[model samples]
Structure formats: structure tokens, C-alpha cells
Target chain A: MTADTTYKVPTMAEMAANGEEPEVLFWVGCAGSFDDRYKKVTVAFVKILNQVGVKFAVLGTEESCTGDPARRAGNEFLFQMQAVGNIQVLNGYGVKKIVTACPHCFNTLKNEYPELGGQYEVIHHSQFLQQLIDAGKITLKGGGTFKGRRITFHDSCYLGRANKVYEAPREVLQTLDADLVEMKRCRTKGLCCGAGGAQYFKEPEPGRKDINVERTEEALATGADTIAVACPFCMTMMTDGVKNKDREDSVKVYDLAELVAQAYSL
Target chain B: MVFFEQILFVLALAAAGWFLTRRIGLIRRAILLGRPEDRSDHPGERLNIMLRVAFGQKKMMTKPLVGLMHFVIYLGFIIINIEVLEIILDGIFGTHRLFAPYLGGVYPFIINTFEILALGVLLVCVGFLARRYVAKVARFQPERHREMGRWPRTDATLILVFEILLMTAFLTWNASDSLLRERGFGHYGELRGTVGSFVVSRFIEPLLSGLGDPGLVAVERFTWWFHILGILGFAVYLTYSKHLHIGLAFPNTYYSDLRPKGQIKNMPEITKEVQLALGIPGADPTEPPAEPGRFGAKDVRDLSWKNLMDAYSCTECGRCTAACPANLTGKKLSPRKIMMDTRDRLEDLQRGWQKTGPDFDDGKSLLGDYITAEEINACTTCQACVQECPVNINPLDIIQQLRRYRIMEEAQAPGSWNAMFSNIENNMAPWKFSPSDRFNWADQLKQ
Candidate 1:
């Protein structure tokens, strides 16, 4: 799908200035905000949201990290600092519903934030897409670009085992009319992308192989032409893994949102 | 002679009961050493979970073959213990087959069922032993898993061998007693009549047929004593061995965390500090602020009681370690080892307390002395280990707590992590990007 240059994204600050409140606040996580590769995913998601006419506004510059990495790395001090800051911003807007494309952000905002007095009805993008599709708002083109293609969904640890949101992403994938295959370890037994617990920031402890490499091998073993992911961390790790095996030419990694956008020609 | 035998049986039973209770009490005390946690909520849900996971062995069924075999052994062990009740009554009253007269024809049917289960237990124990020693399963191998060192490996082997021996004695006692009934020798001949031979043990009868009536009585008496005494000894030994899971698994599964696995527990203490720092205003002015305790777990005592109970409940089955992404990738962090170390540290503290009262300091801690920073840091917080555990034990909670201690208390996080921490502190993200530019990605869409 070609990039839509005329799409104007609204920020929470701008919306509030107009005495407006969106149906849901889009939490653009650190990766979705700044990572070069993940920027495309953000655009694709925005395209889909705009096409569906969902009233969603971004926190924009007001958003901060959900402190998942800090908390997982055992720095509760830094974690609460970032968490409380974001919670205040979210509360200031009186955001009652939130949607994010990142599992780490989704997990923190949905589960961890409530205990810190930042309760919001949070849903991941995959679940949001599934909801849209279920509500007949997202009708795909029959036998579209991804029809009958082999697509394997890598279960992000935060999304699958951690939060038990296994079926929603796969439910979203089912709409593509694609052959959804599974890795040997999928769903509850899914392997990590080797980027959790702040492992993304540092070298892995000496091991026989990196966890992402091992997980990538599992995905490659499935022989799927396209790898579908819902989390940005999995996007980076699995993309690196596809590159490590030099299979970038033969295989492609796309976020669930990106796949939907491409299939819809949004 | 029967009176003397009854007295000996009573003495053995009393000693066994005393020691088992004492050991169990010690274990209870050790588990209680950990900090308080309110897992008491959701009683009805906890009971359902306990029933499904522990009683139903639901998670174990994920691996059908192993699960079926384990189910056989578990069912057999429980059913066979019913026969122990009969043995106890017969011992105390100096009666043979005490239930035989009360139940009439149904007694033989019950004995046959016990015999069949005993045979099943015997065979499954042998199969487990072979799986551990002969086939050398990867999870059970000391060579592959350092935590399966001499003591742990031997403890597993000993339990299996003990079960096999107990089953052997049970079957032999039944076989010889049935033979003696046929011969009309002593109590077996006088009291029991010709209540038909048990189904499984009848096959064993021919082997003891060559031993005459006197030899038959000797075999019957010897196996009867051996079977009951072995059961008594095993009951006492159970608290000291990894086999304690047979009992603790129920309570462990019952009190497990019901929250989403992604939710790392909120530190209210840290929250208060952060709220105060940010001037968020929730602290009560009327009450003097309590002194802040340790940030995270440095010792077993700092861990929640559920964590310590989880350690005691671990079967050391290595399912957690086997499924761990970090462990599979050859990292030093084995979820099973984390549990084992917590248990070992608790036991060490328990030993010290016993020697010099409860205040005794062992000068050892669970964090540094047993588990290393390298091990705790390797965890991906993936929850694979948590998912794989059949009894609902969570190794990730302990790993995170130890990681918290290392980073928050000792300030010993890795160099790159420190950099990431500072970056998040200043930039509101883990990277050194300006928060004002968080929406800069939108510029691409406007092109």
C-alpha cells in the first residue's frame, strides 16, 4: 500500500484545547515514536484507524515510556518515576480508554497501571483490529494480496503468555484469508524474542545461541512466506533474526496492523 | 508372641508419627519465615484452581505419555495407602485381614484392587528410574543440569527405589498370606479361610509355593513387617525429600498468583516514595511515616510466603527449566535452579536457626550465596517457566525480586542497563530521544 501523505493525526493536547475527548487515547510507545522501522507500523496503524473513522487521538509529545523495561530490569525507582509521570498525563486528559500497538505498553497500562491508580480500559491494536473486524467495520478484500499465503504469527511474550491474549491476534490474522501456520512453540508455549526484561539494552549472558536466533529458527522451520507480529520488540528481534539467516529476500516480517493496512490497500 | 509383635508395631507407628510431625512442623516454620502476602482472597477460585491443577493434574496432561504414567503412579500410591489402614488395624489388634470378616466377599475384591495398584506402582517406579538413569533424560541429567547434582539426583533415585521396594514388599506379603491361607497355617490359616487369591499377587504366589508352611509364615510375617515399616520410614523421610511435593502441591497451587502473569507486583513502598517525590499527595499527615524496609528480596525472609511455599512445592521435575528460553539457549538461569536455590537457602537458614535459636544469622543470603546476579539477570521475564510449571509454581516472581534487590539495593545492574536507566530518567524513554519529538513519526505520514 502506498503511504497516505494527507493523513493528519490529532494529539490529545490539541483535542482537549477544542474541549474534545477521543473515544480512545493512542499510546504511541517509545518504539512506535522513534524507532525507524517501527515508524512505518505507526503510520499503517494510523491509516487503518483513520479509514475506520475511529475517534482516536495520540498523546504525542506528552506520552512517556510505560517503564516496562525499567521495571523488568528491577529498577522500581525509575519504573515508578516513568509510570507515575505517564499516569499523571493520562489522568490529566481523563482518558478512560486507551489503545496501543505495543504489547509492553499494553501490558503495563492494562495491568500494572491500575495498581498505581492509573486505571484505563486498555486494548492492544490486535484486539482493536479484531474488534473492528468483528463489528464489520474492517471488511477485507476477498482473495486480496495475502490470500492463501503462508503467514506465521510470532506470539509476543507480553501478549500471549503474559497477558493470555493469544486468540485476538490470530483472530485478526484469520480475516486476511491467509493460511495461518504456527511455530513448534506457539501460544502459551511461545518463546521470547530475547528482548524482554531489558535484555534489549544489553548483551545476552554468554549462551550457546541468542534466544531470538533460536526463536527465528523455529519460525523459519515453519517455512511461512510471511511472519506476522503484534509487538514492536518482536518486530525488531524477528527482523534481526530474518536478516541473521539472510532470508530477508525470501521472507518478510510485518506487524498485524501493517498486514491489515496492506491488504486493505489503505 | 502376638502381644510382643503388637507392642513393637505400636512403638514403630508412634515413632514414625512423631518424627513425621516434627519434620513437617519445621517445614511449616520455614515457609512462614517469609513475609506476609494476602493470597487469601478469592477462596472459591483458589479451590477450583487447586482442584484442577493439583487434584486433576491438568497441566501435566500437556505431555500425554508422561502425564498418563504419572497419573498411574499417583493414583496407585493413594489407593495403595488405603491398604495401610488395614495393616495398621491388624497390627494394633493382632488380627489378620481384619476387614476380611466385616466385608465378607467384598474384602477379596478390595484386596485384589490394592494388589493391582501395587503392581502398577511397582512398574511405573521402575519406568521412572529407567527414564532418569537408563535413558538419561536431558532434564534429569546432572551433566546437562548442574542443579541435578549428587544430592538432588540421589534423592530422586532413592524415592523411586523406595517406592519400588515398598510395592514389592506389599505384593510379596499378599502372595505369601494367600499361600498360607491355602495351607491353613497359623493366623492366616485359622482366621482368613479360603478368601480367593488376589489378582496380581496370585502370579507371585507360585514363587513362594516351594517354601513350606513354616517358611511361608516366615515370608508372610517378614514382608508384612517390612511393608508397614517401610511405609512408616517413607512417611518420615517425605518431609526431608523433594517428594514433599506430593503433599505441598495442593496448597501451592491453591495460593498461586491469580493476576495476569505480565503484572509484576506493585511495590507500595516504592510507590509512596515516588508519590512523595512527585508531590502527588496521598500520604497521611496524621500518622508518622513508617520506616521503609528492604526494597526487594535479598534473603528468603524478604520473599513472600507463597514464594517460599512454591519452593517447597517444587517437584524438581525441570519442566520449567526445560521450557525456559534462557536456559534452552544455554544461559545459567534455570527456573528450576532458582526454586531449588530458594529452598536450599531456606533450609540453610532453618539449620542455623535450629542450632542457635531463631535469631541466628548464617551470614548467607539467597541472592549472593545461592543464586548469582548473572543467573537472575539472564531471565527474559517471558513467563514460559511459569506456564510450564504443572503445580502452578512461579519461578519468575523470585527471579524478578532478586533482580530488584541487585539493582535497587546494591546498584549492581550491568553497565548498559545503567545507561538505559539514566536515559529513561532524563528522556522519558529508554533511549536518548527528546520527548518533544515523540510524535515526529507523524511527519512521514504528511509527506
Candidate 2:
């Protein structure tokens, strides 16, 4: 459950150097790499993969942006310029399956990459974790850490509407034995945290209120102690909303992987 | 006196033809003002899409009640136009019920069928009018949507009211002519078959019964003139109204994006540039080292012809905005507004060209003057708008084009976006960090 000197994590480059291939490539997205908060989610997911003995390797230095922001921001040229580079890297490695915690990356890789001839079995972490749970490869101890806790899962736009992975996150939540309350707008009709379409990087246009603030108010209305998220963007936006509402101390935002990790005390 | 009537009919026909042709020509020119795109591939798929979405009304069927009403209106519009053709021929030749003699018994049947359709059209138009004004369907009211305000509401109401008047005129013409026949007036008796089973006219017979031959003739002539002129006027006015969708739906559905809704198109030009930069094998070389051109669309000219076609094809139904998650979440973005803004800007551009030639620089564009960065940015790119569009119009395409112009051309993206852009350019990711540290998250699993 903790980092030790003798433990080793392999990179795709290192695995290829040793004439080997992992079962899947763990795409540590930008936030997973550098964002302090999302890094914990990334580490938790990695620990689960390690515990389940799923052989996964990081692309490390070879990995690049999927160009989701570039494309969404309307810089198709930059996006393609970025996508083509990443596609070359993935194709060069003959990567067959990819797992990522970010829905944006999952969407771009699963949907957009195929057009540029970089096709692979791309699965979101929530879905992959569900698969692990289904296969009985990972088990929760007793009722799990979220047992009887009032938790509301926020549907990330990319994961929910863009990709239609509504059930997987909910299924993962079900395994926690938590009181999974839902906001008024959930699933297909879920309100966005106003972070999609590269909006996270921009100040909102002169609207009466920010979209995240509106969405956060809805999540808070659920009266759930925990606001569970599956995407880093949603996490950041929801966390900010909670702080703005002065409910940061009362309502905590945890990535799905964070809950799963906490259940195992990893 | 007969000769004068004949000349007036001829002149009216000529005027209608001239104006309709001019309006259509303007639309063609405006559509062509956009950059060329090759949507010529997949003939079979395009045809199938046209038949299913536009002709079959597949998308509209999702809301069965509204869908049924729309189907009735659509069917009436198409089937009733047959009578318009008959009117056109009769108007030109100055013949009374010209088609009636050609097919003796079938003439009555045809008229009866036309009457039924005209009645349907009337009812449906009334229902739509009530939905807009009486019940005030939230989507139809301009007050609920700033983009749709007064002019759009008036435009919609005017068209519906126009249809009601046109149908009334036709039915009145029928009733008065039948009355003339009953009175044994000149040529009215011998001109048409039976006139026996006039469904709508039979009910209207009481109103026209009091008018003698001269009075009947006057009523017939007035209704006749109003009906024909209304048809002509409607045709001309459609080019300026959301009703242009009647003419545009077929082509818009045909050219609609057949790709999976989830797939965002990649720029092939940029792909080639990146390939050469990455030193990929067999990549095209000596193609003039890629210099960045306009990164995204700035004006109507920068958008593809299909996008411009979509603008023209928009029905202003607000279905897209109604389904939009951004709009539902109270964001400023509305897919309907995007199409409206695009169409309005394109019209402005067309007018500018007409006034000052193609080289005229009004210094305004589809981006800032019409659509704003805030609206475009608020989109979740959920494709709810695209999915809900009955005619297959894609507002996301326009939004993306405008966003591209903002980021790539104007460099007007927010500071945080600029930082992310720099991060991607330098570190090959959206985070400002070294690639060597990417696997550090996995190190936490060490035991």
C-alpha cells in the first residue's frame, strides 16, 4: 500500500527494451501526471492494477496530448499536429489496449484516434475497475469504506454523454455499498461542470452564473457528504464549486479510484 | 375586357417568376460564398439519409405528437402543391378549371382530394399558430430566447397566418365557383366535371349562395387572384424566412455528416504536417514546409459549404437548444442561436457583396459581430444538438469553426488556455511537467 525502494513499475520503453509487452498501457493523462489532486487518483488506480496483477506499463516520455483541448478549442491544426504525433507513438508500440482515468483522453483515444488509424481497445478507469470487480480479481473488505455513506456520483460530460458510460461508474459505486444519491440532473441529462470543450482553461462568458457553480449547487442539493467523480476535469470543477459554496469541509470530492483505494486501505 | 384579364394574368406570372428566380439566385450566390468542400462521396448513403431524415421524417418522429402534426403539415404541403401546378397552368392559359376536362370523372376526385389536404393544411397551421401564440410553447416565444426575439416570432407568425389566408382564399374560390355553377352562369356549368362532391365547398355553399352571377363572378375573381398571388408571394418570401427549410431540407439531409456522432474529424492537412515533422516513413516531402495558415474559420468564407447549407436549412425549431446540455445547465450557448447567428451573418455578408462588390471589407465577421467566444466555449460538444436536429443541421460545426478562429487566428483564448497550449507545445501534454515524471503515479504502488 506504500512506495518502497525494492518495488518496481515498468515503462513501455523499458518493457520494449526487454522484449516484452504489458497487457495494457496505463495512459497517465496530463492531470494524472502533474495535477497534485488527480495524481492521488492516478496512484490509487495504479495500486488497484498492481493488486489485481494486471500487467500495465506507462508510455512515459513517449506519451503526448490526445489533442482534445486543441480540437475543442477550435485549433484543429494544432490538435491534428498533436494527435498525429501521439498516434505514431502508439502505433509504433503496437499498443492494443489503453486504460485511462480521464474521460477526455478516453474519448479522444477511443473515438478520435481511429480516424487517424490509431485504433485500440480504450477503456475508462471506472469501467476497467468494474471489470476487475466483476471478474472477482479485486475484493472489498466487508462493506467497504463508503458503506452507508451518502455519496453522489457526478457524471463527467465526456464519460456520460460523449461516450455513454453511465452505468459503469454507477456499478463501481454499487460495489461500495454506499447510499448512492443522484442529483436532479444525472446520467444522459446530467449537467456539465462547465469544463468540457476546453472551457476549463477559459473564464466564462458574461453569464449570470458559472456553469460549475450551478452544477455544484445541484450536487450539494443532493445532501451527500461525498461528491464522487471519474474525470480529473470534473474533480477540479466540482472541488472549486464546493469551495465557492463554503462547503469544502462538509462535502469532499473523491475520484472513483480514490474510493476503491480507500476501501482496500491502499 | 377578356384580353385585359389575360394580359394581367400573364404579367402577374412573369413578375412572380422573375422575383422567385432572383431570390433563388441570391441564395445560390450566398451559399457559394462559402469555401468549397467535397461532400460528393457516398451517393447511396446520402440518398438513404435524405429519404429517411428529410422525406421519412425519422428524427421528428421521436416526439410522436409533434411528429404526427408535422407529418400532416408536410404531407399537405407536398400534396397540395399539385393544385398549385394546376393553378399555374390555368393562370397562364386563362382557362377555367383547365385540368377538369382532360380527365372527366377523375377531376372531381382530384378536387376532393385537394380539398381534404387543404383542410388538413389549414388545421395544422392553426394548431401551430396556437402553439406559438396561444399556448406559447416555450421554444417558440422569443422572450425565452434572446436570439429568437421579436423578428423571429413575427416571422413565424406571419408565415402561419399567411398559410391560413392562402387556404381560405382557395376554399372561397371553390365555393363561389360552385355557386356560380348552381346559378347556371356563363361557362361555370360546362367548365368542370360534376362539382358534385366538393367537401369543403359544400359546407361553404351558404356563404356564397346569396351572391348572384355578377356578385359570384366578383367573389370568384377576387378569391382566385388572392390565392394565386398568395402562392407566388409565399414562394418569394420563403427565401427570407425560416420556411426556407422547406426548400433546403432535402439537400441538407443529403449532405449531413454520416460519420458516427462521437467522431470528431481530424484536419488532414495538419496530419500531413505532423507526419513530416515526426519523420514518419514514406511521408510526403517537398510539399512546401508547412506554414500555419488561418487555424480556424473567421468568416463565412472560412466555413465549408455544408456548414453554410446547414445555416440556410435551419428550421429555427429550437429542438437543438432544447436538447443542449449547456443550455439546460443555464449556459449562454444555444445551438439554435449558433445556426441563427451564422445565417444572419451570412446574409449580411451577401448584402455587403451586393452593395460593394466581392472585395468589400466591412471589417465585421461571423465570429465577433454575430457569435461570441463565450457561447462557443460553453458547449460540451455533447452532440445532443446534432442528434436532435430534424433536418440533420450541425451547429457544432459552426461553433467549432468560430472557436478555431478565436484560438488559432485571433489568439484570443483565455490565459489559462494559452498556458495549456504552451504546455502541450513544449511538454507534449496539457500539463507543464517533464515526461520522465509521468510514471511517478505508478511509483505509489511500490511495496
Candidate 3:
């Protein structure tokens, strides 16, 4: 479904040229920008922002990777090179707040950037969505699509144990009125989807089973038909995991943004 | 003569003290061999964390049953050691139950509580041994964790067996002492008779009932000697065993990383180089750059002091390895093994330093010789291991440093990683997509 012609995504450059400033700069991370599946999440999050009448601008082409993968993979030189470049562009825009759908970017920008003179009030979109919901700015229909449906959220390590945003996403999901079944391992004990630490870039070292597959088994054991994820990396891993188990037809993996967008019919 | 006995006790005390002090000094030196980073900030917060995690055994309670058993042993071990104070004073001053006159009613109560805790410690130690050997808990199994090889396995069993023997000696001594007191044998009868039979040890009194008054006195004295000597021996052996956690856990938890688990420490040295290359406004173009230090940890010495301390603090519980996503999926990396290898390499260096000099090189390093590239690569940096550790050890820090070393210094990263790195460098993303087309996903909105 295409949006009306009135809907236009404002770029930071365009906003600067027009002498306008949005409330928050939406950081469409590498996956949110380039990954075909994760692009939908970016679109869904944008739709939610528009529906809620929240003024937001995207960096578009000016935004670069936050160097999370490089730093995690131990290429500190390359990581810092990317970090400084991104920070300069961010500082150039005078961006004061950032919200992102990617946990990796959220973590790096919120925690790692301040040390190198790049600091802002950065937050994961899950936390942002929870705030909106709590503020009563966004409301779901009485009989939303996810009502009573079994949904198990796969905790993103960067967001959960890393930053302790375990409840924000779950709280957002609770607004859908869906049955949130918990995996045996949840919260601090939650299993990784195996794509973290740049493991997504390379094949896993030979092992009996993939880490994502093991995590998927736990998710499936909860018997939830819908698996929810907060991070783009977890989305790729868990989606691939479902396809690997030949349960793609039965189980669907959706980002929290996508679920919220769909639930509200944005 | 009592004089000779006193002299012997003093000699044993001096020897134990000397050996423990020497070993502790060596450990401190070895840990200091690592590069320094300040973990001394927020003393109040660190104290709170140490109190909760180490003293309160907070994280261990994640597995309630096992945590309770561990709490029993820990509480029993600490409380029962109070009795040793009396033993030591009695040994040096040639006094039998010296506190009995002053303590009066409280003496029997304290002894009764000690007896109960002693029984708890004995039972829990046996249960722990059974969990390791009989039930074959997955975490403790050498078959599951190759790092639990013969010596590590033997080290654990040896401590358990040692504690069991010590507790047995204590109870048998108490039982025999009560019997001798009833017979008013020599010095045993000198007490105000206020310290009655201990609660739990009374059960053992039946076995010693068949002995004569002289035999009972000898049994009491021998077991007393055995119990005290065993404790002194255990203290020295602690420095050499994984049981060092009994002492190191306090400091390790106190200095734990207080930042978010996901926040990997940034390298200021690297940041300077990056700033200079980018010609950032604040970077001094005319000034000469600082000499480059090693990028990451190539050996134990290259790691931080906290990382080295984590190795010594590790109890070899295998909880980290058990929680590791890589190890759970059969990958080669085990967080427990990483800590074990670090400690082993440090010890190797310590021995070499003692034999030759501080500058002596062994032609081996922790990265290549102990922990292999494959093991560190398999880590997902999930922080599950760090979260699972009861003592707040961060194995992820060491793994990340080693990864940094492998990639930056050795340039030994796998082909795909190199490709990804180059892609991120040229394309501004991990994949080979053009940055110009970043907004393509938004085209649908305009349509």
C-alpha cells in the first residue's frame, strides 16, 4: 500500500536549507537502509512517526554506518575512521537527539560516541515507541490484528543485556494486546540470535549447530506463531532461523516497529 | 612437654605465613605485569557491587538450588574458621578452652552453632563432589569442557576431599574431647564445665565410647592437631589452586566494569591516530604523533590488570562456558577456558621470571600458544558469560582485546572479515551497497 502524495520524508540537509529543525533525527542504520527486509522496518517506523504527527528527519545519504561491526570485529582503526566521519556529519547538522531501529547503532551512539566528542540523547526505537505509547500519543484499535495472538519477543543482546532495555519493547508489544509468551531464556539470560559481534558478516566457525538455530528452537518451544524482534540484526538471524527450520510458513518474524505499524494500521 | 608443643605450633604458623605471603607477593607481581587501566572510580558503587555479588552471593542465586548449597558451604566455611582462632590461641598459650571461663553460657551456644555449620559444610562438600563426579553435571564434565582436563579436574576434587577430611577431623576431635571431659582426663577437666557437648558432634561420641580414657585423650589431641594442620596447609594450597577465588572474588567484584555490558572500552590511542588522519580541527597537524603501543593483547602482559585478576578470580565453575552461545552450539570457544588459559600463561610467565629474570621471554604468548584464534573468533560478544559469572568477571573484554590484536597487529582475520572491513571502509557500510542509494527505501513513500 502506497502512502498519499502528502507524505514526504524530510532530509537533514533539506531541513537545514529550509531553516527547519525536526524534533529528533531518525538514524536509518546500515541494515535499515540497505537490507531489503529491514528496509520495511524503517518504512514502518517512519509511518508510525507520521501517524503520531512527530516531526522527524532522516539523514538519508549523509548518514553512515556507526562502525559497530568494525569495532566489534576488532578493526579499531577502521572503526574510529568511520566513527569520526559520522560524528562530523552529525555535529555538522547540529543534531541533538537520535532514535534508531538498529540496536547496534543505538548502543554505539549512546554509549561509545560520547568519548570521542560525539554525544546526543540517543535511544532505541523500542524505547521511543514505549514513550509515545505511555504518553498516550499513539493508541491501538480495540480489536487489533495481534489481539490474543501468541507472540514471543527475541531479546536483542545489544538492547537487553547490553543496555537493559528489556521492558520497553515488551511494554510496546503489550499494547498490541497479544499473548506475550516468554522463551525459557529471557531477559539477562536471553540467548543471542548469533549475528552479533559481526558474526553476521562471516560464516560461523564450524560447529554442530548455528547459534541462531539454537535460539530459534527456544523461541519455537514457546509455541508462539509470531516471533518479535527489536534489532535489525536479530530480525535477519531469527527470520533466517525460521526459514532454516522449514517453519517459515507457520511462524513469522516481524520487527517491533512493523508489528506496531501493522497493529495500528498506519 | 607443653613448651615443645608450643614451639612446634609457632614453627608451623611461621612457615604457613611465610609461604602464603611469598605466593601472594608473586601473584600480585604477576597481575601487575598486565597493562594498567583505572578501575578505581566510584568507590561507593564498587563497594555496593562487591557486597551484593561476592559477599551476598547474588548472581549465584540464579540457580536457586545450587546457590543455596553454595551459600551453605560459604557460610559454614566462614563461621567455622572462628573456632580456629581459639585453636591457635590455645596452641600458643598452652591453655585448654581459655574462653570457656569468660564466655560461660555463650560458649556452648557458639560451639553448638559451629557444630551445626560444620555438618552443613561437610554435607554440602559431599554433595558438590557427587555433582561433579557421580551426577556428572554438564558444566563440570571434562568431556563437555576440554579445559577441565586432568589437573583442573583433580584440583577441584582435591579441595573437596580436603574439606571433607578437615570437617571429619573437627567432629571426631569434638566427640573425643567430650568423652575425655566426662572422664575428667588431665587438663580436659580444667574447664568450668560450662561448654557442654556440641550439638551435631554428639552423634560421633558413640564411636569413641569404646575407647579408654587415655585412648580418648590421644584421639582428641591427634584429631585436633590434624584439623589445625589441615587448615594451615589449605591456606598455602589455596594460592596454587582454583580455590583462590575464595580470596580474589572480593577484589575482582570490587573492580568490575561498571559501564553497560555492551560498551566495549574505546582506545584513546587509536582515536588520536584517526583524528590526525582525518585532519580534525582540534588535531595538531604540526606535532609529532605519539609512538604506537601494541594495538591489543598479544599476551597476558598486554591485557589489563583487571583481566589478569579475573583469571585468578575464576573459580573454574564453568558457568560462563555453559552460558556461552558458541560453546552451547559446539563451537571451540569456551569462556571458562579463556580464563583458565590466561591464568596458566600468567603462571608460566611467573615461573620463568622466578627462574631467570623479569625480562626473560618464553618464546610463547597467551594469544597463539594458549588461546587459539579459532576460539576467540567464535565468541559472539553476547555478555552472557559476564552476566552468568557470580563474581562479575568479564571474559568478553579479554576476547575483544585478543580480537583487536589478531586483526590490527597480525592482520590475521579471516577472508570474509577482511572483505567486510574493506566494504565498510569504501562503501561506508558492511555490505557493498552505494551510500547514495541509502534513501531508495523511502521512494515508495513519495509514490
Q: What lDDT tens digits, residue by residue, belong to model 2 across residues B1-447?
A: 656877888898889889889878888888887777889999999999999999999988988988998898898889888988888787777778888877788888888888888888899999999898789988776677888887788899899899989988888899998878767688888753466638887888897788778988999999999999888888889999999999899999999887655567666666777677778865669767566456568888888888989999998999888777677666788999999988998788768778998777889988888887778878877677886799999898888878877877788877888888888888877877886776666555554
Kindly report which residue stretches of model 2 are placed more than 4 angstroms away from their true locations once superposed.
A1-9, A40-54, A76-78, A114-117, A125-155, A160-190, A216-229, A239-266, B1-7, B98-113, B140-144, B191-193, B278-281, B290-293, B322-333
lDDT of 3 by residue, A176-252 (tens): 99999999999999999999999999999989999999999999999999999998989989988998899999999
Most accurate candidate by lDDT: 3
Could you tell me which 10 consecutive residues in candidate 3 chain A have the lowest summed lDDT?
A: A1-10
Which CAPRI quality tier does the interface of model 3 achieve? high
Q: Can you give the DockQ of every candidate in the order shown? A: 0.88, 0.45, 0.87
* Winner on lDDT (2 vs 3): 3
Error of 3 at A83 (Å): 0.8
Model 3 RMSD vs true structure:
1.1
What is candidate 3's CA lDDT for residue B248?
A: 97
Candidate 3 lDDT over B336-388, as tens digits, reads 99999999998998899889988879899999999999999998889999999
Q: What is the TM-score of each candidate's chain B when compared with the real chain B?
A: 0.98, 0.94, 0.98
* Best model per DockQ: 1
- All candidates: interface RMSD: 0.8, 2.4, 0.8
DockQ of 3: 0.87
lDDT of 1 by residue, A153-188 (tens): 999999999889999999999999999999999999
Q: How would you class the docking of model 1?
A: high
- The lowest-lDDT stretch of 10 consecutive residues in candidate 3 chain B is B189-198
Going through the candidates in order, the fraction of native interface contacts each one reproduces equals 0.92, 0.62, 0.85
